[model samples]
Target: MDLPAKTKNISVILQKPKYAGNIGAAARAAKNMGISNLVVAGSAKYDQEEIKKRSTHLAADVVEKIKYVDDIRAALDKFSYIVGTTARKGAARGPFFTPRTIAEKITAVSQNNKVALMFGPEDTGLTNDELRYCHAVVVIPSSRKFTSLNLSHAVMIMCYEILLASLPACAEIPPKLARSSELEDMYEQIKTVLTRIGFLNPQNPDYWMTHIRRLFNRTSLLARDVKIIRGICRQIQWYNNQKNT
Candidate 1:
């Protein structure tokens, strides 16, 4: 199969999945869509036989090359872009994108940045804390009565959309963005500075930082942008220290 070039930069991450079979099936889905990287994040170990059984011989390579990480955030830290999948919706959970729209966005993002398509565990989707790591969240539109989807099924739907989007001629590639690790570091600095300055509530600073995160995520910040923001934080801290002395 002549796969899309951008697809090579995309990875599918399964966070805290309970079933080995779902992991295997998700690998098969990834292979079908030309995505080679599959990461399993969490501490639980699964039976290899059960995993290989569901992946079958066709996706044996994918299972063989699966990357395991004890922490989802650590796995996500290396990627320049992350898209999370969820079924639930609330004021705090969204600004959600449809699979197709996010796929189109991913194609462009993958042109210059490593992109991760993150799916939460089957029973309970990604927690609010986990979703904070995502630059964008996608919700598969399903019947209102029962919105949840099986883990592998959700992976396949998302992978399919991404594959479809990547089939067309390439558009202008965007500038490379800062990695998640850098953005995370800057967020921590921003939180501290804001709290010290009394701009953010000291007791629950994360709640206020969620809005700040969204603002920066929408901006598609580059490496220089992160440095600029962090420099501002440092200057603020220095001035406050001088005044105290």
Candidate 2:
């Protein structure tokens, strides 16, 4: 069966994944769940033969079309919404949702925005720095004693929920939002202006920026909203210049 139109906008990203077979298996899982866009971030080299061995002939097309980028930010810049998967949880890594919940949310966001589901390396899931790029975080439920999941297995579970969510008809589709690239630019400007005014600690600005990111992520900022915030930053910069003169 063909995937829902909105579901076609979803992309799966693997960051610094360690194994070729895992990548291949992940590709097959994504294809099985009607997700064709697969992106790999990081410079790790993998044996094509091993990858093909795992993906097999059924997912050859997915393997052939997999996108490769040098880093996670570049891989995700064009996407408007990004979800990061993690096994371990902490205060900083929080506000995590189940796969089903996030999948439903993605269904709505994917209606008008490009969505990315990002998974990290097999040994260690996404780090805090990497999770900063994600708008949301999802954790797969498992036994407490053995909470960790295999790389491809984790991909399969998330993909399955997204496919299930896409099966239903959606009544409301949101308007397109600002892409990650745009948001990042606005954030940089905000950070620079805020630091100039001492609103954010120059020694540890990102500590406070996390709160700012959380605020905007929850609001689901649109392109226009980003422009407004950036406009404010520009005005602040102008005021600072006037004061200096």
Candidate 3:
């Protein structure tokens, strides 16, 4: 009963979760889906009793092995692709997808790199600043009047979709996708080149990079693709420098 390698690489991150019981439930959800990695961000006192009570013994391993970090950003370093779950939507959160759609996307990305599904506190979903770290947003479609779901419920739905999406019978062979570190470096180079070429304004640079990130996230850019992009950016930067000199 070993989990798929791709699914095992997927981590379920709870950002500033409030309830210990919910954390335990979330762990159960992740374990049930064959995802073992669980991370909690921000120090929030939770009732361990509730956690033990809710998770019972079936998911004791997940509850025991949960990693704690001070911030959500701290957990992103190891993940190639990050998907943040949010109940609220706005212009800032660009390109939101239903759970099913995001699950498909996650499965594709996980095939080539480590992926994370981030969940915020029960009271408030991911903040704009926190969401900035994510490559995409997964929105669980619900009634407008009551869009928010319980923390564990959200975790369950996300994990369930991902489990279904990760089934070997339905999965495609993935290309060698770029790791997060490589993508981040490429993005930085692109940003530098864009600025050098006067494509991005320094004073009020906003969604320029954000839009680019979303586009690439959807494209499932491979390692080779990232290298090509970085090469082009390097040439642009060099050309800009030559012109200035």
The local distance difference test score of model 2 is: 0.90
Q: Write the per-residue lDDT of candidate 3 for residues 1-245, one digit (tens) a residue.
A: 44454777789999998878889888887778788789989967677778877888999888888888887767777787788988888988867888888777678767677888899889988898778767788889888888889988898898888777666544575666676677778778877778768898877554598777767877767789998998888887788788989
lDDT of each: 0.90, 0.90, 0.80
Q: After superposition, how far is residue 178 of candidate 2 from its true place, in Å?
A: 1.0
Clashes of each: 0, 0, 0
Ranking by TM-score: 2, 1, 3
Model 1: pairs clashing at backbone N, Cα or C within 3 Å: none
Question: All candidates: CA RMSD in angstroms?
Answer: 1.1, 1.0, 2.5
lDDT of 2 by residue, 1-245 (tens): 76574766899999999999999999999888888889999998889889889999999999999999999989999999999999888989889999998887798889889999999999988999999888899989999999999888898999888878877777788889889999999889999999999899999999999989888987788999999999999999999999999
Candidate 2's clash total is: 0
> lDDT of candidate 3 vs native?
0.80
> Which is the winner by lDDT between candidate 1 and candidate 3?
1
